[model samples]
Target: MFKKLDFFLFGWIINWMYPEYYRPKYGYQRYYILFFHYLIPQKLFRLNPKVRWPVHFTSKVLAAENIKKGILCDPGDNNNNYIQANNGIIFGSNIELGPGVSIISSNHKGNNLREHTKGKPITIGNNVWIGANSTVLPEVSIGNNVIIGANSLVSKNIPSNSVAVGNPCRVIKPKEDYSEDLSVIIFNKKIVEKFDVFLNSNV
Candidate 1:
């Protein structure tokens, strides 16, 4: 088909252009073989196909029709993270998802295995950053410019420009109050910044 040809041609062009930059540790090949092979072909050629490409080939995204642009779904420390959107999930541009983040749009209605499950749509706005090990339940609409802390569970809708944390995921404060180091700086900064902020605010 024309789609297949298109994919192959694109892959070939990529292979021809950058043959030496393949990485094996994170799983990439020099010949663009892995790119075309591991790609979810159906997801790649979906409606408005030219929008974006997933960062990792190992990531599993269900119901691509429900997804939108500029999503960064990365693997966890354990590797192999999942994003499942059964009913409907719409994502705006430039949303960054850290490792071990799970966004589930459908859940079981009852204990019965055979019974039909219930689902609701999840819409995440642009410039939102979800931290590692966070789980987003169904029917949750996360607004734009939001930052979710690591190991948090989001059960309800979060308004734009907020910082939410904890098990039930309450809004801690407005995002403007949060330090840029806390929101954007990921590694080896959590403990020191929190302590520093506590000290400064208390003083």
Candidate 2:
């Protein structure tokens, strides 16, 4: 009961203090709402049907018509006004999207920046792990079990079971099943040699 009051008070104070800032910027408002929604206990706000938290929309979040469940969005992930056709975004169970991730589903037609034309939709496969601050452009299909490294800008399609990284990301390694644990799969001789002290401790 007291916690609910605190949540409302905090939101009210933010609204009161920054009316101009919060009114126009939907992104900021969404962040504020989501912060309180998840941070506070679900019991208090669950009763209020009117308090629908906003999903931080970026230049990439086409229409919200096709968004699915089991998506863990970091505070920095922004989906623009990308159209969600037939529920384009199909995330698998246990997908973690890090901060500053941008999943763009549509683009403009003309070269002129002022025009309002639409482009293609983005399709992300199941069990895909997108790292922090990644940008996924339109008309691209990322295959299942793909791991995209942090800060990568994906402009094309990525094959299944691959590791892609860097600016305008390129495939670093093909999909392969290893019998060893995750630590062995990711770290090679270089890492093991350099961090022998820490690795030995874990072992």
Candidate 3:
């Protein structure tokens, strides 16, 4: 039929255009493959063929929303694992998540067997490096430029520019003060003098 042909053509076009984004080397490519193979076929048979492609495309867009908002940090470098992130998570830029890192943003109350749902947002700061197999609990905000050791359980907020380690993750030391603009400290008198106007304005 004409409808079946149209769905096949559209799915093929999507695969060609976004080969890397949908089929990254690190992950299993399960979602991308499923959308085209199983989901599309079922929809075409039962529902309108034209609707199948659009619905699959919308799911991809939702996944991207999670990444851009910093709720789920996937730098295209971490190993693939079954990771789930809900809405309201905020992540900073340049965050590196190692393999098997799980961030849980929702939890239930202890006394209620009926699962009292609580909405907690997880925020990861910029330039953060989370080690492999680490679990970040709900309602936690990790400050910028932090380094978390491997296999650690983060249950609390970590201050900026510190190294945190252990099961319940504790800050080992306070981060040293450094210039954010210039990587190296501006100790040179001439450089400071050259930018005196800019520094004065900032102060």
**RMSD of each predicted structure:** 12.5, 13.8, 13.1
Give the alpha-carbon lDDT of every model: 0.57, 0.50, 0.54
Summarize candidate 1's per-residue lDDT along 7-106 as a digit string, tens digits. 4555455433322212122112322343453333314544212213333444566665565443222221122446776777777544677777888888
Which residue pairs collide, candidate 1? none
**Residue 83, model 3, lDDT:** 34
TM-score of 2: 0.50
Worst 10 residues of 1 by lDDT: 19-28
Tens-digit lDDT track for model 3 on 1-203?
54345436554554443322222222232444545653454354432232212223222122223433321133333443323344445776446677777776656567876663566667888668888888888778999879999999999999998999899999998765333442222321223243344333323
On TM-score, the candidate that comes out on top is: 1
- Ranking of candidates on TM-score, top first: 1, 3, 2
| lDDT per residue as tens, model 2, 19-87 | 211121221234345455432422244321211223333323344445543322221233322223332
What is the C-alpha local distance difference test score of candidate 2?
Answer: 0.50
Error of 2 at 51 (Å): 11
